[model samples]
Structure formats: C-alpha cells, structure tokens
Target: MLREALDEANNWIGKVPGVVMVGEGRAQDGSPTVDVWVTQPVSLPQKVKGVEVRVRNSGDIQAQ
Candidate 1:
C-alpha cells in the first residue's frame, strides 16, 4: 500500500511543479514512510489523491 502510493506519486503526481522525487523513505520520527522530494519549502496539501505527501528536500538542484 505504501509502495503503491510511492509509485503513483512518481508516475503521476511527480509532474507537480515542486516535486523532485517520489520513493519510499523514513519519516522524521525514523519510521518507514513514503517520501516526496522537493527543491523548495512549499506548503503542500496534507495528501495527494488520498495518499499522504511527505515532502523532503532535494538539497541543491542545478541544470548546468
């Protein structure tokens, strides 16, 4: 179930402007969770398409 949400976020929701990467990761509390990597600190909705969106930083993104 968690992995499915990760896939959906990668294949579908990743198209969102701020989304950087979507995959399985750990919650801040160190628990297993899904991750939605982003380049900025935007206020994302609590969930996307019913799956909770956990936004993490992608550090520095450069296209050069």
Candidate 2:
C-alpha cells in the first residue's frame, strides 16, 4: 500500500511545482500515510487523484 501511494504521489512531482520529495510514512494515529516534503508553500489538493496527501515544509534548504 505504501508503494502504491508513493507511486501515486510521484506522478504529481513534475506537474506540481515546489515538491521536493514524496515517501511513505505514518499518520498521528500510526496509520500509513503519504508524506510530501515541499520546499515552498504551494497549493495542493487534499488528495492526488484518489491518494491522500500530507504536505510538510521542513525549511531544509539542503534538500533544495
């Protein structure tokens, strides 16, 4: 499921600007979730196609 979610999120990389990386992670409740690390604040959809999205801004320029 994580792989599928990562794949779905990867599809938005090029299409959506400011996306730094996308990976599988856990939610606050320990449920599996998709993590999207972004460099800057960008308008994003709650879900990409049907996959839920979790956007985070770490302000880590080393990644940029």
Candidate 3:
C-alpha cells in the first residue's frame, strides 16, 4: 500500500516546481510516508493515497 502511494507520489515530480526528490520513508510515529525533497518551499498535500507526505526543504541538489 505504501509502495503504491509512493509510486503515485513520484508522478508529482517535475510536474511541481522545486521538487527534486521523492521516495519512501517512515514517519516519526513509524507509519509509512512518502518523502518529498524540494529546492524551495512549495505547496503540497499532507497525504497522498492515504499515506502521509513528508516535505523537506533541501537546497538545490547537484549530481556528483
């Protein structure tokens, strides 16, 4: 279920500006979550497909 939610969340990448990365993770309470990393603050939903969406502000990312 969480995997499916993560897959659905990945679809938001590129479609939303500032979004750099999307992956699966565990929330503070140990519940499943979809992690979203962005270069700057952007509007995002609190949850997707019943799973929590955790958004973090990560300055611009560069490939090494």
Candidate 4:
C-alpha cells in the first residue's frame, strides 16, 4: 500500500513541468526518515489537481 500511495503522489507531481521526485529513507540507527519533496511555485493557484503529502517527522499526509 505504501507503493500505491507513493505512486499516486508521484502522478500529481508529474503534472508540473521540470518537477523532480526526491525520495529519502531511514537507516537502522533510526536517525531520520526523508521523503520526496516537490519543488513547485508558490504563486500557482489551487486550481491545479494533485495530492499533497506533508514531510513531517511524525509522518503525516494531507491530500487534496
């Protein structure tokens, strides 16, 4: 199910031109878990369709 969620997230990011997906994982030492972050323009309107996953230390997701 994680892959499905990630794939869905990637689809939304793909809509943006010149957008890149960056994924980060955690280590056995339990240091930190990094995730994919999409670099989009802040000026873009909310009219665009896509899912949003928040990168937080506590692991929270917000989809639209």
Segments in model 2 whose C-alpha atoms lie over 4 Å from true places: 48-51
Task: Residues 1-64, candidate 1: write the lDDT tens digits.
Answer: 6767677667765787877777776666765566778887766566645556677899888788
Q: Which ten contiguous residues of candidate 1 have the minimum total lDDT?
A: 43-52
Alpha carbon deviation, residue 48, candidate 2 (Å): 4.2
For 1-64, candidate 2 gives per-residue lDDT tens digits of: 6677678778866357777778777777887777788888887767655556788895756734
Best by lDDT: 3
TM-score of model 3 relative to the true fold?
Answer: 0.86
Across 32-52, the per-residue lDDT of candidate 3 in tens digits comes to 988898998889999899999
Question: Where does candidate 2 have its weakest 10-residue lDDT segment?
Answer: 44-53
CA error at residue 25 for candidate 4, angstroms: 3.3
RMSD of each: 2.9, 2.6, 1.4, 11.5
1 or 3, greater by lDDT? 3
Q: State every prediction's TM-score relative to the real structure.
A: 0.63, 0.72, 0.86, 0.34
Better of 1 and 2 by TM-score: 2
**Higher-lDDT candidate of 2 and 3:** 3
